[model samples]
Target: MNFSTELIFALATILLIPIYYYFTKLRRIEKFFENFPNPPTVPILGNARDFRSGPAFFKSIHEYTRKYGNMVHIKIGPIGHVLLASDYKFLEFLLSHNKLLTKSINLKFLEPWIGTGLVTANGGPKWKTHRRLITPAFHFKILEQFVDIFESAGNILIQKLSKESGEKSVDIYPYVTRCTLDVICETAMGTKVDVQNSETSLYFHSVKEMCRIFLARTTSILKRYDSIFRFTKDYEIQKKSVEVLHGYTKSVINSKRKELEETRKEGNYSDVDDLGRKKKKVFLDLILEATVDGQSLSDEEIREEVDTFMFGGHDTTATATSFILYCLGQNKDVQDKVLEEQEQIFGGEKCPKVTYTNLQEMKYLENVIKEGLRLYSPVPLFGRRIDQDVEYDGKIIPNGVGVIVFSHGIHMNPEYYPNPEKFDPSRFDNVEGKQPFAFIPFSAGPRNCIGQKYAMLEIKCLLSKIVRNFELSPAFPRHEMILAPETVLKSLNGVKIGIKSR
Candidate 1:
């Protein structure tokens, strides 16, 4: 009886192959769907349900690619997701129209958190205008000025960590967040909140809470549709928290506006803010610098850009730094290479000024940062809607429907990097012949990260300074902390590591 039962089960497994093929072919014949490069999805809800179900993404995505080809199509309800897990096609599509494809607006969750900033703004005139207006502020020469703020903040962080170095392990999450908060405050709002030492600054805390809520609550349909849940706990927290942020920004803008009046009167017209007070010469001043133009952005517009930069400019870079440290801790050979690179650059010397030029000098360091981004991507996926009917993959992806792309799959494809799981930076070497879209840490094309130069500068400085003194080790297992989905970015188990002076 047992032998007969086993024989029947084996026969059933063989029979199912044709059944599976018939269904897959039938779905294609239906033509409303496509295949994605991952494990066989459960149809309709596809991989979306798996992601929404839990945090086994690294394994899930890997499993899918092994079964399916490099690029897979998935449908969750009416939504279409093109998981370009392979390297070449992903890069081709991304780089070919970096401005259009790299610009994502299909997701429902980002609307609130990003509002109208670079990350979530629509791609046409509004973005162009905002991008144009804000471009001058981040000009390389101008960004060079912000390095002092980053360096100063970096030092404060080092000092605090130095005191706690003997500690078994430290939550570098807050420390890194503080460092970035300090940068944004000085760069965006013109108010230098020293969050480095006091991790609980009001705005800083609010930003964190808001980011947490936004990620937890944003549903894809709502951003595409109008199903935003006003009463939900996630929505409520995000709305109130964003309001707090807006209110603070308004106060700052008001002060700047008043001071702008005084400066105009004085004729010298050096930057100032409301209440006739002096403020840090930051991005706020630069935005207000052009308020005289009749076409200046509205207060809402200004705030949106500010909010966008605050989240976009800082969070991913922070994650990148944290991941870099994690990778360094795990791979001692790579870490040693980094340390050797650092020592050569700053031999027995104090932390450098961290100018734009210094960042270019640290080529190996840049590769390390890129490798970290690939493994534990800050944003594992980016979504977009085709504004007009466009031909893609020999099919017309009709306008207005949602389309999602996966970096988690794209970066891990063996075609782009050999042994995609390993932490290797050499792949980025002689990137000249590399396909246009293969590597996009900050994205590519017109709408890519505006403050990328600023971000790299800060990363280079922090790494240089940190490597000069201490070696890094992992906080704990990377999987222990779940990746909390947020409006802006991702984080892992609070990336704690032991710190010791070299």
Candidate 2:
């Protein structure tokens, strides 16, 4: 045969080998889960077409859960099969294990942005070390110090809102997001990044653009491949965002290190209270001070953790806070109840700040926040890679498969939460009585969000202040607000609310 014919034959043989193996693999998967319910799949693509981005993707998953009964299997091209477990028991089985600690390959896309920080790190020695080293940064006393920052940021937010009170429909999202960004920056890195009031900031824009690109890439099968994605405009934006965000973190890390060195050299490191702890050790300071197994973290490692916190600490909290406000706006009676609770705490006190003690007193407000999180979880989905075969309800999820925990669906499970669609805060009144993994807004098990308490404190501080200072009403009807999950759950239309000064 001629050279051209030989090349064509070689290419055909190469293509046929994978095609044959793909069919063989598909047949085996089908036989393994023959008893289970699966959404229909087509040749090569499988159920890839069913998984779209944002609200539609979530809506489709919910529909599948309703029809397929929680544990549904889906296949996406050459990436392999994903078993979505919306059932609480399955989630418990998946999350409670030490071996299944590695995030799914799907989340590998986030490595470019978050690196192998605590949030995205696989469950291994490195993750254990990072978790152990970083846990002290969120000590109760440390968080208590952060309460002041929360109050300061909350005050700034209230002041900013007061200017627009009763003037027009204000989109509370941007304001709350900026405020949270400020709080995280100050508390996490000891840097004052006032992106909230700035008309334009490279760091702020980069973070926002990165989120948009991240979400787009995560949801699109076509964009999942690095070879294809790198050529796209989204990749360009993502690259710039990483540069800006990482550069910002590096600068802050360097500045903080210099200050620490200066303090040590000046013999001012003696600045400690009776507890023998530094008077002020922000998250970065703690990381710098930390030694895991007698070795301190390098500058790059410090930056990774800082960037992880900078992204996770701010964005998720901001989205949750904004949604909570939107939920309160939709339910005026609930808003009144929250305000009443705030009144009971602050009682005719002008310019009251949310003290740590005050946070404890606002029990009802806490439930309100919990209920909001249940209805609108900031993180709708959690993905995990199945390292070994997982058996659930007599079905075998073979090794190397991807498992997705649909947090939103779990929160909405009728079996767990009666009248799951209702906005009743009383559901959380007896939280202990409910299933352990049913309402995982901050997730469950070992890998649960470490900053959850901090998030709650910050949210309570901000919401208590805002509800006290303004009467919030939804600018649009409750039913009209479309929920979309882009990294965090958000309203497709901005969270617009009418704010009247109280």
Candidate 3:
């Protein structure tokens, strides 16, 4: 062959090797799951066509689990086999497995935005060390200090919503999201962006756009691969979003570091501030002081964790808070009970300083939030990559497969929850012998969300403020929310409700 012909042949051989090996491995997985239940899939395309959109994928997965049983074997284009599971027993096994701690490949989509932060880190020494270093940051003492920030943000949210009250209807998602953004920014990074008041908040808009891009990328098979995705418009959008996100995080990290150094040099790094009150340390302060592998973390490392915190800290809580408002709006009885409890605690003080002790006493409101999370988990699904054979239902689930823990499905299973469609906070009132893994809105296991407690506290504070200040009713009483699957769960139709000053 001529030089050009030989070069083309060599390149083809190089590319074909992986393809040959991939199909060969795929066949083995196919054989292992030959008898496993699954939806009807076309050849080559597998089940890709069924989940061509985010909403379709989310709806279909739930349907497939309900029809084909809890454990459904699904094939997605060239991505190979995934064990979609909603069974509590199977989820408990997979999530608690010591070896199955690695997150699935789907999380790679978030890497551009979050980098290799705790959420995206694989199971290894690095993950362990980072987890160890970061765990203390969420101590009760530190979290107690965040209540002021939460209350402050919530008051701002209530003021903004006051203008919208008495209108036909208003979508509470944007208002709640901006409020949570402000809380997370100040609490997590010790910087106040005031997203709720800022008319042109680049970081807030970028976050929302990035979530949209993530949903778009997941639904389209062509966009799953970097080679094709980079050529698309979503990639361009993602590139811009990442620049804003990363740029903002890096700047915050640098500023925080300088502040830390100044404090230490001034011999004012004691536990108390100039006012003699105990100084509250933000999450970023802990990260800046942390050491890994006998060395202090670099700015990039600090930025990764801060970015992860910003992403996880705000969006999930915002989604949860919005859904809780929707549920309360739909069920006036529950709302009244919550308001009564708020009254007993705050006692006619609208938007009182919700102390940690006060939060502990809002028992009924806590259950309401729990019920909302049960009905509408912010993260509907999360997955893990199995590295070894797993035994379930007297069958061996071979290694090298992805196991998706369908939290939404588990929450809706009538066996675990009677009349699962109904919204009842009382279900959580008595949980003497309920399965622990059955209700995992923050997931279960060693890798469960570290910020879960912080999230709950923030949600409670915001809900307390809103519920105390306004009387809520559903905009579309009988209409259901059109669920859209994104990094955080969102309603495509917007979470709308009617509001007026109480």
Best by lDDT: 3
Error of 2 at 53 (Å): 4.2
Q: Name the better of 1 and 2 by lDDT.
A: 2
By lDDT: ranked, best first: 3, 2, 1
Residue 234, candidate 3: alpha-carbon lDDT: 83
Model 3 reaches what TM-score against the true structure? Answer: 0.94
Instruction: Mark the regions of model 3 whose C-alpha exceeds 4 Å error after superposition.
Output: 1-24, 390-394, 476-478
Candidate number that wins on lDDT, 1 or 3: 3
Writing each residue's lDDT as its tens digit, candidate 2 over 74-171 gives: 77774467778887777888878777788867667778888898888889888899999998888788888888888888888888998988757888
List TM-score per model, in order: 0.82, 0.92, 0.94
lDDT for 147 in candidate 3 is 90
| Candidate 3 local lDDT, 357-456, one digit each (tens) | 8998988988999999999999999878877777767877667877778899999999999999899999999885579899999998899999898988
Q: Which is the winner by TM-score between candidate 1 and candidate 3?
A: 3
RMSD of 1: 10.3
RMSD of each: 10.3, 3.0, 2.5
* Candidate 1 ranges beyond 4 A from true positions: 1-48, 52-54, 78-87, 98-114, 219-228, 269-281, 291-294, 350-354, 474-492
Backbone clash count, each prediction separately:
14, 0, 0
For all candidates in order, the CA lDDT equals: 0.68, 0.84, 0.86
